[model samples]
Target: MQINLKYFASVREALGGGETVSLPAGVATVGAVRAWLIARGEPWASALSEGRALRMACNQRMCEAEAPVSAGDEVAFFPPVTGG
Candidate 1:
């Protein structure tokens, strides 16, 4: 399936703004999408690694790793935001 991706904050700095991705079979959740990106190596590996403390959204709504994803859905990743 194909989906639009978004990167924000420091994640944007590392992975750039965003891009479209065609996921392989079994990549059905937000976490799976993350794993797929991390599998690509290079900046992706470091940028989306499991160790990173990042936030995710599916279709512009806040979501956890179990969030369902679908074709044409928008998935976003970013460092958590805070205000003082």
Candidate 2:
């Protein structure tokens, strides 16, 4: 399955900004995707560590790491919002 991943703020900085990646079909949750990304080495590892305070959105709606993912979904990752 292919997913469009958008990274923002601190997450973007850590990942050198956003990118799209093709994932295997069994990567069905946000947590699984994060784990797959971390396997890519430095940038991914630091950006998606378990201690990071990250937020996510699926198809434009806020979601948790346990949220389900499907083919062609758009998932976004970012730090906690600070603006008013």
Candidate 3:
């Protein structure tokens, strides 16, 4: 299924904005999508690593790793924003 991805802030800097990706079956959750991208190795693995502290959203609403995702849904990733 194809999902639209959006990267923000530092994540955007590393990944260059966002793109659409056709993921293999069994990737039904946001975490799975991140895993799939990490499987690509290098930049992906490092940028979205399992240990990394980050934020995610689905269709513009904040969500956790367990958030369900479907074809055509938009998923976003980025480092947590901090303000003084």
Candidate 4:
């Protein structure tokens, strides 16, 4: 399945905004996608690292890593927001 990924804020700066990714036959979840990207090493490994505090959304709805993902779905990753 092909998925559209969107990065925001610092995540975007680190991962180069967004791009399309293809997943081989298997159950692909939000967390799985992240892990896949992190496997790319370097900036991807660090930016989407499990140690990082990042928020996610699927099809415009906030969701956890375990959220189910489907082809053509738009997944977004962004850091938690803070205001003064």
Off by over 4 Å in 2: none
Query: Which model, 1 or 4, shows the larger TM-score?
Result: 1
> On a 0 to 1 TM-score scale, where does candidate 2 land against the true structure?
0.88
Candidate 1: Cα lDDT at 32: 94
Give the C-alpha miss distance for residue 28 in model 2, angstroms.
Answer: 0.6
Task: Estimate, for each residue in 1-84, the C-alpha lDDT of model 2 and write its tens digit.
Answer: 888898888887777566778997678998888888888889788988878888889989999889999888988888888877
User: Candidate 4: where is the Cα deviation over 4 Å?
Assistant: none
- The whole-model C-alpha lDDT of candidate 4 against the native structure comes to 0.91
Query: Backbone clashes per model, in order?
Result: 0, 0, 0, 0
Question: Which stretch of 10 consecutive residues in model 4 shows the poorest summed lDDT?
Answer: 20-29
Which residue pairs show collisions in model 2?
none
Candidate 3 has an lDDT of 0.94
Count clashing residue pairs in model 4. Answer: 0
As for TM-score, the candidate ahead, 2 or 4, is: 4
lDDT tens string, model 1, 1-84? 999999999899999999998999999999999998999998999998899999999989999999989999999999989999
